[model samples]
Target: MAAQVLALLRALSGPEAPLEELRALHSALQAVPLGELRERADDLRLGPLFALLGPGSRREQTTLCVSILERLLQAVEPVDVARNFRVDLQKGLAHPSDSVKTLTLSQVGRIVESSDAVTEILNNAELLKQIVYCIGGENLSVAKAAIKSLSRVSLTQTGLEALFESDLLDDLKNVMKTNDIVRYRVYELIVEISSTSPESLNYCTTSGLITELLRELTGEDVLVRATCIEMVTSLAQSHHGRQYLAQEGVIDQISNIIVGAESDPFSSFYLPGFVKFFGNLAVMDSPQQICERYPVFVEKVFEMTESQDPTMVGVAVDTIGILGSTVEGKQVLHKAGTHFEHLLMKVGYQVKNASTELKIRCLDAISSLLYLSPEQETDDLLRMTESWFSSLSRDSLELLRGISNQPFPELRCAALKVFTAMANQPWAQKLMFNSPGFVEYVMDRSVERDKTSKDAKYELVKALANSKTIAEIFGNPNYLRLRAYLSEGPYYVKPVSVTAVEGAE
Candidate 1:
């Protein structure tokens, strides 16, 4: 049915062709399920319709052509769309008809948005030059369409790399220098890049994009500001972006948003992105930079950990890990007693159902806190928690053990590294041997047999093997055997029952 209808439509291309047949074919094409059209698209017949989108085509032919391309782009491989219509699509964008230009640009954006594979074609330097040229075209609708296409193209890796590689940003800056209306389209491109591509995000930070984004952040649009915050979060993904953000007083700007969140609920809504932005900034760059730049950031992050809102809590947990992962950050966390208290508070917070990102954050925060904690607090935490071998209450020891058993190797290793660091400390070693099945949890990492487990178990056993740490539990033969199994060598000792101890006494 499609082939027959398409055939009639193609036959109507002549000047003498019937208008009735043109209307019928246009309606027929729209009525066909996109899937059916895709499955039955005869290139031999449809190719000419695609060609009709170029200059000199009649208005009815061009509109129908755009409609067909729209459907095909949705259902077919975007790479195929680029291949079949690349020449015509480019021509349509350059056509005398603004409608043709607009429709072609919209469809091109659709292709770029949907197919990760078609970026290579869209990235063609010459093709991109044409698209960029159209971005400043006199027709307002045409230029907006070009901007929308550029935004979509900026969403993927190849398209983004091309945009970053090309002179597009320079051109965009020049265009926006005098053109206020075009700047909104530029804002769309920036926000789209900030939201979607980390590579693009990093590039935007240095290529005058951070300056533009910061400038536009003064605008009244909530989305632009929200997306600007989002761009900061993306900048957090790379070292360059973070340093640029910090050096340029973006933190001060961000704090204004965070501080302003107190009054405006709508403004407050964007706090998660701010949370992530600050969190990422905390880790990749200097701790001194984060601390010196944002003096109250640690306290802000701590308050968030205890929030009733789970998203705030999750981002806060991640922020804490990054903030405390460094020596300076850890020292800052340790000096402020409440930071560790709040961090330990999250240990048992929905441990079983937490997302992997949250779980990793939990492991990291606990590990860093353990590393920075004073000897007395560390011992108290271990002893009191070890005393709860049979209790329902949450404590740091159980948190460590639970994190060790989690499915993520990175989480397990992070937990174990802290334990290994503390194994030489009496407090940590005592809990390892006496906290009920803790030794087995350390050695029997058959739960996950990956290389990290083997390596972690080796380091842990070597730490626990110290005779000084094992002496207290040697009176229990079960402890002796478990220690022997883990520690190896002359440390191998047999179990003695209670009766034997009684006999000795």
Candidate 2:
């Protein structure tokens, strides 16, 4: 039965093969019992079944072959099949027929997924070259399948190194430069390949692919730009790629994308990705160079805090936060104190009007910036927070209160963190501590809702720890009752109790 199926597939693969003949072949293969087909899947002649998938040829026969291969792959042990016909299968990857190449590559990926030995067979340098060659082939499906197979086979550092040593990187660059549709497909392959072996950075840089891709950042097509962003992101995963980006001045191009407006409908959708790319680049490049080369870029980002689009505003805030946390970034913000104040005012307003996530991001960025700013900037920071706190609406206050109760430790940490910074100041601390027993009020709330107020209680404890006057006030006999209740609070509360007891003694 397997012999008959193979002969029929061969006959149907020919140009002279009639439609009726192909139909007959399909029926015959489909009629083969599952057990027999599974047995034949283990045979070497299974390699020829791939040739039947011609573009204009027997659709019915092709579908049946696909179904049979899917079954056979599931049922047969790939190691047995790989050992029996590994060379024939590798040759099928480069067959003149697109159908053959596609099916062969798909089966290869499946075989590799099923058994590590199959990958060992495909990992041969010569065989790997054939697979990489198919990536530049005219057949889209075949090229894509080849890429998928390469991703699986190149799991090892040695395999990945061999792939980069091959002409695969050059082939991918050619496809990306020449064909728009294929460009998208192949760029993903490039990302996959580069991600697995960052040592491939040498190949990318030597082949000048990095410069080509950097130019794509400003392409008119959003998808092209998006794919470029993904590739660059993956490439930037390595020290070499990061150093190349800095040496090549790629950040300037990325900054242009961020500051420049697009008239296309989908351009706005890509803006967030652009912003994220810049954020990653900021992390990768030296902060001193970023501040020196892109001073205007920094200013524009500060201005983008006012963007009505929440995504744009959120990304901008994140970028600013990243910058502000860096040393040179701190220097930039410190030098531009007036500009920083204006940006903070806009961010505070956005925190009031933005969505909960956006507001949280805005608050985090502002808090991070203030946390990193110098002591001389403390007065300026406090003045801004005071003005914003005074004007906060009921809705804004409710958001802050809800944020104070967030489940994620980090969000609550950020919220209380800003409050700590604000409350440590002379005027702000006096205002908050003297707000008709505000410290007592917070302590009472912390005790009553100990479960939800871990962060709040923690912050209150630290606030007291840092202030002698606050500690003395809490030590008074009237407040001692509240302090005793806090002693019996949650585990996080006990440490503070121990501290207070130590101080009192």
Candidate topping lDDT: 1
lDDT of 2 by residue, 1-505 (tens): 6677667655644444455665566566666777786666545254455445445546566566555555445545667656665776776675666765666676577676865565665456666667767776787778878778877755655555555666655555565665676665665665565555456555445555555667786677777787678777776766666666767877667767665644455766676676666566666676666556666566657656777777778878888887766555656665765666667667767765667677778777766564523344455555644554444443333455456666655556556666665544455455654555556545654433444456456555555445445444444663455455456543434344433455564
What C-alpha lDDT does candidate 1 achieve relative to the native structure?
0.63
Cα error, residue 488 of model 2, in Å, equals: 6.0
Q: Residue 100 in candidate 2 has what lDDT?
A: 58
> How high is each candidate's TM-score?
0.50, 0.56
For model 2, name the residue pairs that clash. Answer: none
**RMSD to native for every prediction?**
12.8, 11.5
**In model 2, what is the error at residue 214, expressed in angstroms?**
2.6
